[model samples]
Target: MERMDGVPPEGEGLKGGTHRRTDGQVGQWRGVFSPGGGLQPLLPPPGPPQPLPYFVRRSRLHNLPVYPRLRKSNRRLTELRHVEGDIWALERELRAFLGGRGGKEPEVQVNEVTGSLRFKGRWEGELREWLLQRGF
Candidate 1:
């Protein structure tokens, strides 16, 4: 039988490969070369940064607030969120007024879901006007 050398043949295993041993213990490959057998770059060099879109650039330059969800909503971005908040405040005020905290006595119960005030009494002159002005 013929004898072969310990060195691997070309293209058969790691190219330019070398190993170290400590106390006859052969250490694994710790070099940075790619194991794929090629010297190609791991990643292509990054390209120049892209420019922002017109609206995005403008908003950023002006420090404008962005409302992403408002575009899909029924309201415009220019509209404030205070409409519902105003309604809620009016409901609280009406509840207080109905509970005799507003120096007026009226038989009325504010609906929770619809926020409508139902008058159980026939005295509807002043209370009706107040509720109507508050959009209830």
Candidate 2:
């Protein structure tokens, strides 16, 4: 082979790492021997961005009594929903049957012996006398 600086070229360097020709020619390996082409530097792959999480609050049944007006207002406000094939409409229609609206206060019924106060309101199938017995 040929002498590159002080080191002697291996007899068959093309089979190894040395840049040399097989025919004892003095050319550096390259320019032709590589079938697929030249070496390329390794690279990293690209990826998607991280996403954020979503959250929500939960509710429980104990809070219903805290808003008395809201609790009572549900039926009055949505009177139509309470009506329909059901008997709620009948209850509303018969509300006037409860008594006269003479005073601002809701009608009160007091037991003669027990003296307990009771509020009365109409129901779907119950008789009219139950209101005088119960209170509103």
Candidate 3:
């Protein structure tokens, strides 16, 4: 087990040792040469690149007083700051309750001199369950 000139001397035709040189002759010794000698196939060096699992959606706005704040410089927007009263009539009743909940109608952006409302995408748990069923 000490012959390494061109490999292939283990069990005559060494099958499982993987030194691979099954005796067909002509410049045998299969993989692991490379310094510009060519052969290379041993693998296992690639690593890094796997981040996509997001999930997060569980805040039905409890004990509400109208909080709603997720705008980190626009992560698709969802603000609602301070907002005392009549912010454009709560943005026209939140666009008529999201246009009667059927689809398309989610861009409400009435600032009214900084009263704030901005909701474009992630409507904070359906706008805090429509302002806690209009009792906010």
TM-score of every candidate: 0.23, 0.15, 0.20
How does candidate 2 score on lDDT? Answer: 0.28
Count of backbone collisions in candidate 1: 0
TM-score of 3: 0.20
Candidate 3 per-residue C-alpha lDDT over 1-136 given as tens digits, one digit per residue, 9 for 90 to 100? 5243454343332211233245744343443434454344443225642232211122232234334455577457677655655567667767888778888788777766756677677667777786544434
- Which ranges of candidate 1 are over 4 A from the true structure? 1-88, 95-104, 131-136
Where does model 3 exceed 4 Å of error? 1-74, 78-85, 101-113, 120-136
TM-score ranking, best first: 1, 3, 2
RMSD of each: 26.9, 35.5, 21.8
lDDT (CA) for every model shown? 0.35, 0.28, 0.54
Candidate number with the higher lDDT (1 or 3):
3
Model 1 per-residue lDDT tens digits across residues 1-136: 1113223343442233344454665444311233555332223225643332111111222222212223444522221111222344544554566566354554444444542434443334444454343322
Candidate 3 yields a Cα-based lDDT of 0.54
